[model samples]
Target chain A: MELFQEVILRTGFLALTWGQLVMWAVGFTLIYLAIRKGFEPLLLLPIGFGILLANIPLTPLMTPGSGLIWRFYHYGLEWEVIPPLIFLGLGAMTDFGPMIANPKTLLLGAAAQVGVYFTFFLALLLKFTVPQAAVIGIIGGADGPTTIYLASKLAPEMMGVCAVAAYSYMAMVPLIQPPVMKLLTTEAERKIVMKSLRPVSKLEKIFFPVVALFVICLIVPDAAPLMAMFMMGNLFRESGVVARLSNAAQNELMNIVTIFLGVSVGATMPAATVLQPKVIFVFILGCAAFMLATATGVLFAKFMNLFLKEKINPLIGAAGVSAVPMAARVVAKLGSEANRKNYLLMHAMGPNVAGVIGTAVAAGMFISVLAK
Target chain B: MVNLESPLSGKILEINMEVGQQVNEDDEVIIIEALKMENPVYCPATGVVKEIKVRIGDQVNEGDILAVIE
Candidate 1:
């Protein structure tokens, strides 16, 4: 009878709690969204699976040293190896031709960062520490890796929630952006078709990364690590001499780092930590940040139109939130709906790519200001 | 003689000139598409199109010869 009792005590069922059960349900929901809804599947699938593994009562998957997921989280995230490498991959894949063709769109990118500062103050009002608030505020930039990078540095405990919030908002771009975009711009503004961009010269394309790197690094040394990696990746791609390195950066390196990043980020989402009022507030503030960022971009474009001779479709301004091709595509689609003849995809790409640089700069600024 | 090559890797979406056609410098010669963006390949010099090397839907890489002009 004593032996039987020992076996019962050792079983997982004996140690299970309601919180763990709820976390399992959360994991299942994330998996369902990834599979059924196709929401950020590459990252969400691993994250969901990791959450499930971590939440199991007797599992060692998330223990300090012995746990597999914990090892991935500690080495990959805590040490801050993955996010910058992901930036390298992003730089490899990014094409700066559009931004080079039209230098003015950089303003739209800067404009989109308004939400970051707005949310910074809002988080302070909500009683988060300066560093924690800065991390939360970066969700406005709508760049997942930057958010993860900043959160891991500034507010380690809030890293998982902020990463989730940033990605969820990124995935929800199609749903969240259209309403804000429509509410902000008039039909005429949306329908306005801008002129085609001048073709950028090969020499300009080759020169851009070096010049950009020099300027950004000099201005914001704190952002140099990510900026340097990103610029180096861009240099590899544009220099056209290192196809093998560029290909590896874009494909194999990106895939490997993404897997580690997703699972490790998931491991941070234990029910005890994730199910709090602060987490909920983070989500709400995240939505607000996205909306505000979209609005500010559109507004800034409108402001620029007042001075420029050739008018731009204000819808493209919404692409400044750094959701990359998705936000740009959304602007293109909306522009087409407003006027089928207007093709805005290429034009929107200028600001879309610019937003990536802008977000990195903003994170660097925050780190410079607050982390010290 | 002028050698025409694609500036990037992509599928040839269209060829705007025929062999033996007269072309001006900077004329849009072909459309190469990569990463869902279309790039127009231009002629380097005013010349007669001597040969067309790539067809519509042909996959090309950077610096691959696409045409010969004389």
Candidate 2:
């Protein structure tokens, strides 16, 4: 009878708290979103499964030194290895042709980063510490890996929530951006058809990554690690000689790192850490950041049009959120809705690609200013 | 002999020309799909399509000979 009582007392069901049960539900919701809604399945799926594993009572999966997920989190995330590798793959896959074709769109990309600064101040007003606010503000850039990198460095405790907020907002770009974009722009602006981009020469393509690295990194030495790796991967693709290496970087390397990154990030979100009123506020601020970034991009383009001889489609400005192809596609869809004959995909890609670099630079600035 | 090569690596989606066909400069000779975008491979010089070296769905690398122009 004593043995039976001991066994019952030791079982997980007896020890599990309501907070853990709520976290499990959140995990399952992430799984459902990944599978059914197709929202960043590669990332969200592993993260969801990791959440379930981490929440299991007395599993020790998230405990220091003993758990596999914990090891992944500590070594991969805490050491800051995964996000930069993800940037490597991102660089390998990105084509800067559109951005090279229209150098002016780089300004739009810079303009969109206004959200990061704006959110930083807002988070401070909401009573977050300077470091926490800096970490939270990066959620506006809509670049998941960069956000994770900055948060892990400056505010380790906020890493999981900030990553989730950045990624969820990125996935929600199609929904969040369109409403803000529509509200900010007139039909005439949306319907503005951009002229076809000039074809970039092969030599120019080969030179861009190198020249960009030298100039940008020289200016912001803090951004060198991410920027150097990013530009190196791009040079591999553009140089056309290291195809095998580029392929590995984009496919095998990226997939393995993503699995580690997603699971580790999810493991960080145990019930005790994640189920806070602060998280909800972070999400609210994150959405505001995205909206502000989008609005700033559009408005900047409109402002620039006043000085330029050839006007740009202000809609392309909204693509400057570093959500990669999704933000650009949203701009294209909105443009087409205004004018069916208008093709804005390639044009938007210029700013879309530029946004990735812009976000990295912004993250670097935050890290240098705050973390140092 | 003038060699017409693919400017980018991709799968040959469609071959738009045949051997012995007269081609003009800037005329698309083949459509190559790379990075999910279909790029039209235009004839760089006005010439006769002497031979087609690639077929539909063949994976090509940058600067691979797609056709030989005479």
Tell me the whole-model lDDT of each prediction, alpha carbons only: 0.88, 0.88
Model 2, C-alpha of A362: deviation from truth (Å): 0.6
TM-score, prediction 1:
0.86
How do the residues A192-228 of candidate 1 rate in per-residue lDDT, one tens digit apiece?
9787677777789889999999999999999988898
List ranges where model 2 is wrong by over 4 Å: B1-70
| Clash count, one per candidate | 0, 0
Q: Mind giving the per-residue lDDT tens digits that candidate 2 earns over B1-70?
A: 7898776556999998999999988786788775455666778789899999999999986568999988
Residue A251, model 2, lDDT: 99
TM-score of chain B of each: 0.97, 0.94
Q: Can you write out model 2's per-residue Cα lDDT over A1-372, one digit (the tens) per residue?
A: 999999998889988989999999989999999999999899888888888887889777888988889999989988989988988999999999989989999999999999889999999999999999988888988999999999888998898888888888888998999998998889988888787677789999899999999998888888887898899999989999999999999999999999999998888888999988888999999999999999999999999999988999999999999998889878877887897556577788899989999999998898888876
